[model samples]
Target: MKLFLTCPKGLELLLEEELHQLGVEDTKQTVAGVQCHGDLEDAYRICLWSRLANRVLMPVYQGDAETTEDLYDAVQQVSWLDHIRSEGTLLIDFTGQTRAINNTHFGALKVKDAIVDQIRDLTGARPSVDKVAPDLRINVRMHRGKVTVAIDLSGDSLHRRAYRLQAGQAPMKENLAAAVLLRSGWPARIADFDLLLDPMCGSGTLLIEAAMMAADIAPGLQRKRYGFSRWTGHQKGIWDELVAEANGRKAKGLSQLEISLVGRDEDKSVLRSARQNAERAGVAEFIDFAACRVEDLEREQLPEGVGLLVTNPPYGERLGETQQLMFLYRHLGDKLKEQFAGWTAAIFTSNPDLCKVMGMRADKQYKLFNGALESRLFVYPISERRPEQTVREEEDVVPLSDGAQMFANRLLKNRKQLAKWVKNEQIECYRLYDADMPEYSVAIDMYGDEVHVQEYAAPKKIDPVKTFSRLQEIMTAIPVALEIPANKVILKQRKKQQGSNQYEKQSETHRFKEVNEYGCRLLVNLHDYLDTGLFLDHRPIRYRIQQEAAGKDVLNLFSYTGTASVHAAKGGAKSTTSIDMSATYLNWAKRNLDLNGFSQGAHQQIQEDCLKWLRMQRTPAFDLIFMDPPTFSNSKRMEGVLDVQRDHVDMVDAAMRLLRKEGVLYFSNNYRRFKIDHDALSDYVVEDITFSTLDPDFKRNNRIHSCFKITHKA
Candidate 1:
């Protein structure tokens, strides 16, 4: 007889190999399943021992199904009395459809009609539909005008091992958990007495599955129900003998089992659920459950031996959640290196970018699925060399050139000079070095412990090879001078960006670092783009807005990441509106606001061309408005190109129209040669407050940006 065993997608090859190991040698891999030649005894053994299959199906009929009538006839070809009695309950699981049967519901209804009609005609009785528990569960699959009717021997999916009585958030199915263990090489590791640990083991799914596989316990041993339990053709004697054999094997396997299994989660409730689940699976004595954080994991948790640490941490789907979870992934990697050196680690996550900050190199990576979400499993062999030791080894060999030593001396002097002021102002992010020397034209800024270095574009007369050498010196000097590791330095080249080029992503590494700026928490990515989310030149201006924003309606135009708007909202603004042209920045702004306890209601973000939006306003509604248009932009998303130098008067006039009689509008830009057209805007009084808005870090480059204060003339 031929049997079809179904599993999740991407596991077809594994499932085929598993069937071969079970003595069913003739197997063919197909989409999400495997087809094999097996007798009744083999089928029974698979239903008990197979860990990756979702269902075991025995084909009963095969014929053409070009229409609904043809499908009914194909199902009727099966000998109904041999499989199920006329008075028994049945359920039909229909998949696929034809032109005549346009949907699965209608196809299933037609199949049910055929089965009941045949049974009633023969014995004057018919089975009623039972969705929960059925005496006969039929599966009908139609593909390309052909139908294959089969009896489902496994009622529920094999993932439903009847051990997980309660589940935590985003739980992994049992079959997938089993596959994760198998792929991580847990079976081989167990034979060597290597320990197994899951740091984020919610509900103990991975732990219980590993225990079952190690103890020779059948995955279906705890399951009290199956589709074949009430089928008329079920061979009771064969199934009973298999069960007895499995029980004996399990007893022997348990007596010899000596490997350690440990699970840890931060949530106490989930840990309780995990313990209960382990007990129900009859593996509670073999595993240890604890409520501990990954960052707190120590070397004392296991004996001194090479082991495996496997876990599926939360991979958030939203931008805000992803930013917050980056720290968690980093901590997990840090702990693995610090405490579990010489061991192997496997991390399963949906977001691959999070793996970049793991601080270790992966030996192997495999793509799999956690239900519908595509995910990756990365395996790493933790090296015994510590991080500090590696850093010291690197420093001893890398000698700085004369120019780099001079630049490093300047960095030390600047940091010492700003130390007092930074402490007095409670500033966590500030510029440590600008182009102090003519030879090196790079700007270095410190955001907490991380450093961002931007090298200015060299002149056409400069040699490319010489410029590259200078950049290398800067990279070496910054880390050494700052006493920070080389990985903490994020380097990028500064060049003129046209239109939306500045907003476009330079890389896909979504590593975000959180910094505190005057009691407000903000996220900045130094490597993903040309500009970090927060602008250091406009720091004082944002603080000015925050100081005067109490109970005022505020507006921020071209609000990239909404740093200014966040400051305004934190100042107790009555309402805030942030408008930008890119949905990416708008979502970024939303995340910034949400990070500071501001949500949907009084805070609004609109994705539109700021100039176009300003013209659409017909009424005076805002008391304070800040406009920081780009110097030049010809983005395709906008109605027209925006040249701040040429169009500043008109843009300011449109924005001022929405300001009340006593309201004030702050207009700023970075066009160094931009001069205000005084004659064009005689209705409002404008003051150039550029010098007042300049902070100490930007005082060296006085023309970095221009600021103004405009109000209705009295």
Candidate 2:
């Protein structure tokens, strides 16, 4: 029989290579899968052991299907009784589209119609559709009017190995983690690397996959269900023998293999999840979990033999993340250089440019994908003999692209343009250049001694290499033009953060710098968070809060780092309350209050969801409230998803309830599509203060955020 093993794009060649190791010959690589000639047992073997395959498919028919009628006719050509039972349940997963069938769902319906009709005609009954847990899964692919229908041998995608009971933020799929291990040639060279370590392991997906592979455990052994089990053509005898063989090998492999594994993460909650996942994978005894920061990785001991270090480090997808994560990358490189003399390290990340900061030249790199975004697996041999690039050379006067030259000229122009305004307004920090030039897509801001450059995520059509080259030129240009050292120039990429991602920590830097905004001395962290302690665009807003805060009981909700709370405390508020879910930021808030020399007698910081805290409030209503919630949040701690645009009404009302009758509720959000929800807040008089909330620097981009002053109608 002919079979195809599907996988993520760019891993087709890797999957084919894995099949070759499994003794399946003549495997041909396709776009996102591998085509091979294999019998039932060979197909089952691939399903059981092929770590990279998303699904194992057995094609039963191939023909043209241009129309609905044509698809039905072609699907009817297959002998239904020989594959699935008429009494059994099955489902169709249709892919691709034709002129007649413009969507997957409609095409799926047509295919289902054909199968049900055919089965009914032959056996006087039809198989029912059970999508949740189908007995037999059928895959139909339509490409350029041609369709190939295959019976899915693996019921669910082979990626679901049933070991990962829980996952950390941005967890890599189990199969992708397995592919990373396989791509490193770890299985074939298991004896070479006795110790596998993941320093930034969140939930230990990589370490668990590595451990399972080292133990020679079959990928599908933990899975209790298979598509072929409920099929009429199932071969129980062959599958039973394969299962027993896999079990015997696993039992023996565990005792014989002396390889050890260790995973570490700074977050204790995250380490707990990794431990639970490892235990579920049944390799808990072989691995150890610890809570440690990347900078402190030197204390961990490396085994006597060759060590393999694999990590899925943070590839800062947003503007602030890149700058903060650069420290992490640099630390990783430093630790590897100081220790692990004879080790192989594989770092998988979507942004390869960030990986360069490690100062370690990648000896081997394979193109792969975490999802839709193209990624790379960079393999480095940690040794004194290995040649690596010096990060200092970033300023070595390389040829600048027209884009880079334009970027530098714009920075100079913006600085010249904003200098007079800065002097007149006494403004220390503001947005300098915000993707003003199309090609050089980045926002350059000066925070006293530091120049923060945020690269806007480029379109897919743009070449990433040219983009980074242009960025490196800008990174070099900023210091020379501004008379600052290269070390003071911070860089990051601006990408829209989604879900509860912004609350998650990017680096364990724990570093903070104090800077002046207007007349207030506020603390800002260029590293460790996507947003610094202060929002530069909201400088005027904080000033407004300060002016209105005197002789009032002030409240700051979602008060990250308590920058606004500090402003309120400094403004002589009779009482101030700061509410936030993150303990880290709350602690920073306390420190910010201390730095400003504010008394703690009436200043309070409550750690919790602002919404929940507001609900518990009744007496001692606040005279002023600054409520700036996240644009969207789905934190596990959150009761439900928070879409600022959708839930702004309820949020505004809740904060209003905590405000005195004559008090003002300053409700604001960075969500671009946010509106004031006039109908929901009919009881309050709403005034749009967004325009008045800007200084000269933010006049170019007033829509970056929207603010409203809401007051109860008297």
Candidate 3:
């Protein structure tokens, strides 16, 4: 008999090898399934033992399905009584319909009509369709005017292992899980490793699969029934013997298997589901599940031995959130480096660009499909020490070319020009380079030992090749001029941004350090957001906030990272209210206040939409308020869009309702094309403070931001 075994599209090779290992021979690989010559016993064994197959099918007939009548006629000729009883439940799974059939549903109906009509004619009773649990399943595939009808030996997809009663969002199919393990060589080398860990185990699919393999347990053992068991052609004696042999092997093998499996996830609900799934799979006692974030995952959680680590982390669905996910990749890399030495990791991810931030060089990579998304399983052999940084850190210091030398000279000139102002103002963090040469077109700033580089987005008219060439030169010139390692530089593109765009995270490294500016020691996170937690350009604004905050109540709106709030707290503001929507940065703000000894009462941090929060405050409460709304913001949390240029009057008026009789509201934004509507603010004394806000470093780029000090006309 010829058998057809179907698996996921990308798992054909692995499935082919798995089928061969299961004592099946003469296998030929095809598009979605493999065709092999096997007896009844071999087919039954494949259904029970083959972990990579979705369905084991027996071809009954093949003919033209170019039209609906042809599809019906082809299915009717398969002799329904030979495989299924007249009154038994049946299901027809049709695929690849022709132009006349149009879709799967219509084609399945046509095939079902023919089978039901034929069974009724033979025995005066037609089989009923039972979608939930069918006695027999008919497989139909129509492709290029051809049709192949087969009996599905496996009632449900083999991927349904019957173990997972609960799962996390977007759980991996069990067969795919098995394929991942096989591709990682875990099954053959289970004895070589002491344990297997999944740090981002959403529902323990990977861990459960690994445990079953290690214990030599067939995944099909726990399933209540297969389609063939109810079919008229099933050989009860042969299948019963295979079952007894599998059960006896599972019992003895599990008793002797010494390897352990551990699964950890950040979500508690999913951890519960993983445990439940493991219990249902009968491997609950062999695997341990825990709720812990990947960054917090440590080697101490494991037994004292090197093992394999496998994780399928959430691939960000949106491209804009690349920075946030990058943070996670780097953090995963950091934890793996800090611990898990002499182990191995198989990290599966669809975002390759984000994976680079992990900083681990893959020893091997395999392409696999997670449904339609083409993903890679990157295998890394963890070493005892951190691998060399991907970026060249200790490049040979060579003399600069003339153009680079000229660029270096201008940098020195800028440093010399700003030296006195920087010293007299007691500023430690400020911009040192801002496109000093048009060719560079990158701003370089210093935050202690770090170099933050922002490449200005070039215009469409400019040649991308030339722009990139200049960027490469700038990358080289910055380190040479600054005498810093290339790794010390954090490079990001600076484009026109709105809402929380600049402040939104890129990486999960959560890497923060203390940096000082104008007598204020604040925290800065370089590995996360597009902008470091501290805005270097806002050095003077923070200082101004500090100067005027004495003996006043302060409110900081859109208080990102709350640097301005820290200024107010330090300058002896009676009380401070810092509001922003992102909990990540708000938590950072709370830490900054603690670093400054202001974590205690009266310094409040509220997570709310600033505009909405401002509107609700009708009482004149704050003595001084700093309002730095983004030029444009349309966060989901907001009731409506916030365009500073269009909504400034209404927003300012709302803020004024909370302002004390003689209070000041310092309004600033980075909208380059902004012009204050002087007529709209006729009722207030609005002072243009953009020029004064710029220190010597930013004197050349007034368009970086605009500031205004608004007060009651009286």
What would the per-residue lDDT of candidate 1 be over residues 433-545, giving only the tens digit for each residue?
88989788889999889998877878768764466567667877988899998878877766676676666675677988898888789999988987889999899999999
Give lDDT tens digits, candidate 3, residues 267-317.
Answer: 898899999988888889988888888767878867889889888888777
lDDT of 2 by residue, 183-299 (tens): 777777777877888999998999888888888889789998887878788899999999999999999988887887889898888889888887887788988898888867763
Q: What range of 10 consecutive residues in model 2 has the weakest lDDT sum? A: 385-394
Best by TM-score: 3
RMSD of 1: 9.1
Q: CA lDDT, every prediction?
A: 0.87, 0.83, 0.84
The lDDT leader among the candidates is 1
Q: How accurate is candidate 2 locally (lDDT)?
A: 0.83
Residue pair clashes in candidate 2: 318-493, 319-493, 319-494
Residue 333 in model 1: lDDT: 81
Model 1: runs farther than 4 Å from truth? 20-26, 39-41, 81-90, 96-106, 116-135, 165-171, 235-256, 265-272, 291-296, 311-539, 542-662, 667-710
Rate residue 514 of model 1 by lDDT: 90
Error of 2 at 372 (Å): 1.6
Name the candidate, 1 or 3, with the larger lDDT value. Answer: 1
